[model samples]
Target: MDKCFYRRGKVSLSGTIVAVGIFMLIAVRGMGQTGNNSVYRLTIAEAIEFSKSQNKWVQTANMEVNAADEDRKDVIRAKLPIVNVNGSYQRFSGLTLFTDGLSHATTGERKPTPNSAALGIDALFNIYGGGRQHALEEEQHLRVNLARLNAQDQSGNIALQTATQYLNLVKLNDLEKFLADQLNRARFRLNNINALYRNQKVTRSDVLRAEVNLSNVELSLEQNENDIAIANQHLDVLLNVPDSVIIIPADSAGMTKPEVSSLLQLTQSAEVSSYTVQKAATSVDVQTAKLRSIRSANLPNVSFYAAYGLNYPNYLFFPPVNQAYSVGFVGLKAQYGISSLYHNKSKIAAGKIRVKEAAMQREAYADNVRLDVRSHYVKYVEALRRIEVNEHSVEQAEVNYRIINNKYLNQLALLTDLLDADNLYQESRFNLIKAQTDALSIYYHIRYASGNL
Candidate 1:
């Protein structure tokens, strides 16, 4: 009866422990879900969109474009006709306006206190210029375009960086899993060696060696786990998420070798609209406009103006009695400055030099863009080949590991041989992962270089 009671008590304790564990697990899961609710889940496309819309640098570039647009419109409107309304009212103790033989004057004007108010609109429109207005407008337009392209370039860079961090995190997770497996295998081997040593079937040295290997594997696993945590932190920083939040990435099993596209086509596209080339093209336009403006310094500008007003010596309330007069005139105004030494010669010479510099910059830009496209294309091709080679290597390493492990278990292989095979397997796995990730990154880069990004 006592034995039965003891068994019952032990079973009851086990059940209670399990119940507590289940409750804790449930609570932890609930907390995780709640935390996840506040975190944003991002897809690749979503990341790109967020960079374009919300990244600080990209948003600043966008605002710059907007400001440039406003400035351009202001410049254009400045060249157009503008109107102003004028109104005034005043009271004076004494006022005078000379007329005829006697000076007509208001003296001691105390009747309802004198007041005057008038309202009129006048406009000034640019009739002719040295194309300075056009040059300024063109400059603003180029600036806006450059700002837009700059934003696009920034978006591409951010997206690439985010993707890189995400892939690194994935690789770290895989490394953690690999380390965990190795640790478990080491532990099992250590237990078996211990049993053999106790039975005098294995040498004491073998048991000691197994224990050392187990310790090493444990340390490695711990380090890998720490690496994974650090990788997660980096990913969080890139996404602007809370560092404590968990990010479960989508499946990464589909990594494959990237294929190379036509280099000529990519280069051609880059020549037209790649970020670097586009910026250079915009600069040329800006500089050209500036040069034209400098040349316009020698030309004259003409404007027209008109104004009308009413004056009275007393306050004019509602439709009170008032003296109203209208005046209009049309005239063309022009001004030119003559300089002897440096005005015309230096400005024109400077503009020519600027034009030459812009041309040289354009040439350099074209060459650099072509080189960039070609280089990235080569990298993409090389990564493709590396991926293929690494994939085969991984397969061979896995087979070698299995064979060596079986041989070691059967006493046909030395422990060192097995360890060597294991090392090869791990190295191959790492190379495969690196090659695949690199290929994907290179593909994205190719797109970016080709202006698709």
Candidate 2:
């Protein structure tokens, strides 16, 4: 019975260990799958979304916007009534008292304790500040708006970057496919040439030429793959993803060309819609408000204040010793700095100059935006034209390649001629892909320049 029990316990222990091992294996595999599943299959829109959420620059700009909002709130809160509570404790080495003639004769000596404590609550309400407060409030509001516009501009820039990278990845992917196909064709040709050489139908030099062609095609394929890897790294940086994470572009077909607006229309829209222009305009308003705020310094400020407190050794009209008593008062006050009348002229002039400078800066920025819009619009149009031309070139090259290939097989054309035709066809295809991607990228860029993206 003891042996049987021991044997059963051993069997149970082995079974438990195996079960645990299997569970651990499954858990590890599940973790691996979770990591692998992190790969992103993103379209341009999705990439933009991820960039807005993850890109460090965009996040920094967003923080600036939040800081501006808080500044505005601080300015507004400063305009409201201010309230505070304060307390103090003190212990003096000695207290001094003056004795009247009668008290000096009646009591020859006097002693005092030195401990004291006091607490108070006070409130102040601004009645007027010569419109300085209002001007400051307006200035803060404009600053907040400026910050928001800056963040919007940053977001547009990030979107443009994501779109550009995404488009380039698609182009590289297409190029890689092209190079792969070319490599395969080279391999096939080399095999055929080798067979022909063995059967005495082709010379050894022809086989050597085919082998050299295959090696060059292989080298091109490797270079194309390196380009793809670099492009992927750039995109990964933009998306804030791990460099090892593969990002497969879901929309390999590329973006459609946006409708081309006339230069006049694009420029007109950019003038009003561009974030850069709007930010510059807001800056002008802020500077103007600052000038108004500076001018208000010449006027007197009015306020009302009240306080309630307890004190030891009351020092009011009635004499009380070592007793706590409540005291309260309310009053209105006005203050004017007479020196401001003499000292503020230069400051006001400087403020005015700053305002003028801001306005001029705004005009300059608007002009630049117009030029940018026009430049991108022209590029997009030119790209479209190139795409049309490349399309026909690809067709002709394909036909030429077919004719040359047939001649090569029939021993009527040199291997070099066939290889040249194949290269032309491939080059035409690559040019078409490049032009199409360029047109799409430029279209998005135009929208970004117009502040529409």
Which number leads on lDDT? 2
After superposing candidate 2 on the true structure, give the runs of residues whose Cα lies further than 4 Å from its correct spot: 1-36, 89-117, 199-201, 253-255, 262-267, 318-324
TM-score of each: 0.78, 0.84
lDDT of 2 by residue, 1-453 (tens): 111011101112354355345434544554565565545566676666556556678768878888999999999999888999999887766434556854553322222336677889999999999999999999999988888788778877887898899989999899889998898888888888888889898899999989898899889888888988898899888866678867777676344555565334655799878889999899999999999999999999999999999776555534436667788899999999999998999999999999999999999998998888888777888998999899999999999999999898889999999999999999999999999998878876776787766
Residue-by-residue lDDT tens digits, candidate 1, 324-419: 555555566676655623577787788788878887887898888788878878887888788779989989999999999888776787777877
lDDT of candidates 1 onward, in order: 0.68, 0.79
Best by TM-score: 2
Output the lDDT of residue 415, model 1: 74
Q: Give per-residue lDDT, candidate 1, residue 21.
A: 54
Ten residues in a row with the worst lDDT in model 2? Answer: 1-10
Q: CA shift at 165, candidate 1, in angstroms? A: 1.4
Go through the candidates in order and give the clash count of each: 4, 0
